[model samples]
Target: MTTPLLTLDTVACTRGGVVLLENVSLNLLPGEARIVQGPNGSGKTTLLRTIAGLQPPSAGKLQAEDGAIAYAAHADGLKGTLTVAENLAFWASLFGTEDIETAMSAYSLLDLRNRHAGALSAGQKRRVGLARLLVTACPVWVLDEPTVSLDAASVELFADAIRQHLGRGGAALIATHIDLGLKAQVLDVAAFRPAHRSDGAFDEAFL
Candidate 1:
């Protein structure tokens, strides 16, 4: 069998001396897409950050093939001063790739190439961030609320791009509250909640 693209074993997290999650385990195989759904403050963002290696888990082991993952967060992470094309060019350079133009065209951002990212609307900035994903040859994508400010058409475009990625043997972990219209395995964080708290108020230190 092929090796799983990602594995998390007995993971736990604590923030500000509070336990956010405990004993969480997951394995993601190539070409798989997992949707993480939870109500507000359910550690959904924390889980994504942990998987992306942005935040260290308080305990447990998380492993992945080096350089195989790319993470896109709710914040577009764009430089307000940089033009859309310049921003993509910078990311592509850092990744040692040169397909920025292709990505821009794919996302229909070619016409807006000269516009500063901050000047664009919320949806446009999201598109710019999403376009960065295409320039990388990474196999794993971790997206946090990728469709937050997108229109219906842009949402469809994003979905289509993700479908193509999966078709190319890539895996994805998405934290979203809405349906992304893709074939994905659901990972409901609600199941991991402690039994005592039926109020739906997530304690930061459940782990």
Candidate 2:
């Protein structure tokens, strides 16, 4: 059997003394794509953040094979001062990868290479952010609302990129309200809510 890329065992989170998730568990395997869906305030973003290790879960465990993951959040996280190409090059360098020109072309950002990211439109900034993912060699991607601000054509482009990644044996955990036209296993976070909070801890009944 193939090794799973990610595993979450009884994961839970609390912020400002409120429970976000309670005993959430899931696993991701190679070449599999999972979509996380929930209404606002359902702890979708909190779950992604916890999985990315940006925020520690208040309970349970998250396990990964190693350093084969890339995470893209809702905020573009681009440096406004840098030109599109400059930002891509910087990330590529950190990943020890080359082919910046090709990566930009794939994301349809070749024409905007010389433009400062801050000066770009919202959709353009989002494209630049997506371009950074292509430069990384990581095998697993955790994307939060990747389709935000993208036009229909650009959305299709992004979907094609994701398909290619999965076709190459990469796995993804995407959190988005908008559909990206790719088949994905779905995880609904609302099912894991706790019945009550007692002594600042989530009730274990939901687990």
Candidate 3:
């Protein structure tokens, strides 16, 4: 059996010291994608954040190799002054990979390479952000609403990139409401929410 790239065993997640979800567990294996779904306040983002090591889990065991995961959140993490190619080159340099062609091509950013990221529209910027994932060379992807500003065609482009990533033996854990046409397993995090919402249990915005 193939070992999972990430594993969580009865994990619990918290925000602002209030436990939101517990008994959460899953394995993210190579070539697999898992879609995380739930209501607005049910901790979907929290679970993804915990797996990405952005914050500590309140309880249980979570295991993965150090630096094996790449996380993409609402923010594009772009520098306004840098051109699209420069941004990808910078990220690739950070990961010790110099090839940005594939990343640029994956999101159809070849034409926008010379354009400053700040000059692009929201959807174009979002594409550039998603393209950075390919340059990172990480085996695991942790995404939160990656399609925020993407149009239908751009969404398909993103989906194709994910398929290619999976084909290369990478895995993904995504939090999204829209279907990207991948045969991914679904994890409904609502099942893990605490029965009673404490006064301290704030929305994910606080995270």
Predictions in order: lDDT: 0.86, 0.86, 0.92
The residue-by-residue lDDT of candidate 2 on 1-207, one tens digit each, is 988889999999765567878999988888899999989988888888888888778789989966677889989889999999999999999988987886798789988999999899999899888888889878889999999999999999899889998998898999988878788988998887777755344444334
The C-alpha TM-scores of every prediction are 0.91, 0.92, 0.94
Residue-level lDDT of model 3, residues 76-193, one tens digit each, is 9999899999999999999999989999998999999999999999999999999999999999999999999899999999999999999999999999999999999999998998
What residue runs in model 1 are displaced by over 4 Å at the alpha carbon? 194-207
TM-score of 3: 0.94
| Backbone clashes in model 3, listed as residue pairs | none
* Residue 53, model 1: Cα distance from true site in angstroms: 1.2
Model 3, residue 189: distance off in Å is 0.6
Question: Which ten residues in a row are the worst by lDDT in model 2?
Answer: 198-207
Off by over 4 Å in 2: 198-207
What lDDT tens digits, residue by residue, belong to model 1 across residues 85-172? 9999999999889889878887899999999998999999999999999987789999999999899999988998889899988999
Clash pairs, candidate 1, are 18-205, 19-204, 19-205, 19-206
